[model samples]
Target: MSEKSRFEYVREGAKTRDGVDIVYYEPNLPPGSKAERRMVRLVAFMLLLSGLAALIFVAAYIWWPFTDFPATDGWEYKPGNSFMKGYTPILGLSLGLALFLIGFAVLIWGKKLMPHEIALQDRHDGGSDPEERKLTGNTLAFIGEEFGLGRRPLLKVALLAPAAGLGAAALAVPVGMLIKDPHNPDELFRTGWSPEANGGKMVRMMREDMTPIRPEDVSIGGQITAFPMTADGLGATNKYADSPVLLIRLRPKDAEFLRSQLHHHPVNVGGMYGDLVAYSKICTHAGCPASLYEQQTNLLLCPCHQSQFKITENARPVFGPASRRLPMLPIELDGEGYLVARNDFNGVPVGPAFWEKPAA
Candidate 1:
């Protein structure tokens, strides 16, 4: 353990040079040995596996059957669209595998291929002279030399390939999010209720069974969950999850109160058909179904967090964590007397208040 018996990699073994201790130093594999080549190849294979999994993740995240396209009738969850269920799980598994392989590759590289050394350096009272600085720089260079990248070319390429790929993926995530343009009147701001989604015709409010609803269908003070009727029923699918609406037949007194408060809730202007007022089923707090309607109280309650929206005041949040009102779906009777959206919600598509706020 004396300085004279120091490892062959060093020239002069100054025991206390620069006020540091080389307590331990050993390589897991000798530099440029045949056995070292084999270990590098093994680590390279693991890195390759990690890169392959990462590529799979990127492909599945972008091009997989993730979207419930209208042409495919995405609502049925049948043979045609069942593959969509696997999309999320694939994303999870591939990303997870990619990360796991990278981690394992790093572990094996350190334990089986890289040098094993320990050094201790005491704190300095002042900046070092030129000699100390040169030694410090050489120390870093020595660590890199221990990896033998110059002597062995394969290790360099193996490290660079996966490192570049993983770097790009990491950059794409946060950068991609920061660069998205949220201002929009279509997909982001509008929903299935928008006339644009229904070929310029009003989207009829249909029941779960696909039957159009008339004014008489929802009883007085009663409410019903309704989806929009489109040619492919795209309105009914999770593609437009925020589109499900609560068509509540407000009591005469409540309807009168709503009309009187229209000045404050201007989004509800011409938003009702007689006494029937509709609001988004998705809660403004956390996107839970604000479905539990308390008839006597005229309160729409989100059972998830006990948030309450007073129906008589345009479904404005009066309790719990919700600070914003539910988006109102404007409704009127079509020529067939079935309820239909007069237009899309007056503001952004319904969800948590923090969602998209369109510039237009």
Candidate 2:
């Protein structure tokens, strides 16, 4: 057969017409040559090293210790075995070495024993010719007939079962997430701020750890952050999300004017606690934690979008994207004489107004 015919018939699909090809060669050595024996031994050594790395990878997987995070009291996410610390790095090194050794072995075998050659083949546009297509079609048809799928329905079903099982395995992963309710889009909107939380009782402000605030923590002409002190206390993180209050100690004269000026202005629960008022720390613009207070100017600034709020009158937005006033956190002293929130914001959504609600 001609060289072209040999390539088409025997080595069909061996190489593309881009002058690239893969060849396998058996070693050839002159008799009694010590160097030839040494080369074979070196190749065997590399193969053994690759096998040893693979074994070590399996051993590490079964025995190595690993920790995902600094341990939090009861949260142990990983198995606490001794080898865990080095588990991942050892596995990576072993796998990488195994692959490198295999590649290096093949390159050495090629350089030491394989004969090299350069051959040319034809390249054509579009696709294979009609004759080649006919040949491929006949080959596929021969294989189909040999399997006898049309005559053996049981064999066809058996072959399809594994493929269907694989497809089902892929779909099963997302099934758990589909169990969530599709209808509750506004679940996050409802909170302890709902009227039912208080039974018309006051919503007292507390700290992140559920301790009520004292007027002393907030210096005169200064501000402090506070959260709702609900029955759930510090455990109620969600309530605290919307309950941040900027407790401002106003000048007595300004505080007196503010009480009369703003409708539903905050008041001191007792005789000595005058000029102390708490307003929602949540910026009316985009609900940033508006904690940056300018003591002299009495302006609260949200770093996120520069929404400036004037605290002297009420926590009213004086500049930027914020149009509404910061929601006032009503305050009163609890039994221990510590400041606490009187109630949630009176029916006002503390953040930016929705399309349904008018701008302040």
How close to the true structure is residue 188 of candidate 1, measured as C-alpha lDDT? 46
Best by lDDT: 1
lDDT tens digits, residue span 202-293, model 1: 89999888889999988998999999887567667776677899999988988988989877866678888889899999998788999999
Candidate 2 residues lying further than 4 Å off, grouped into runs, are: 1-201, 264-273
Q: Per-candidate TM vs. native?
A: 0.64, 0.43
lDDT of 2 by residue, 1-360 (tens): 545742243234434323224354233553236765576566656766666676566555433321233321112224565435465678689767866775786677567634343444566688777866666566445434432244234434443433343333334223311222224333324334443355555556566676767877777687666666665453247534666677778877767766765654433222124788777777877888888988778788999999998776566778989888776655667687776555455555666634444345
Weakest 10 consecutive residues of candidate 2 by summed lDDT: 66-75
Task: Give candidate 1 misplaced runs (Cα > 4 Å).
Answer: 1-27, 30-45, 60-97, 110-185, 321-324, 352-360
- Could you tell me the lDDT of residue 357 within candidate 2? 45
For candidate 1, the lDDT comes to: 0.75
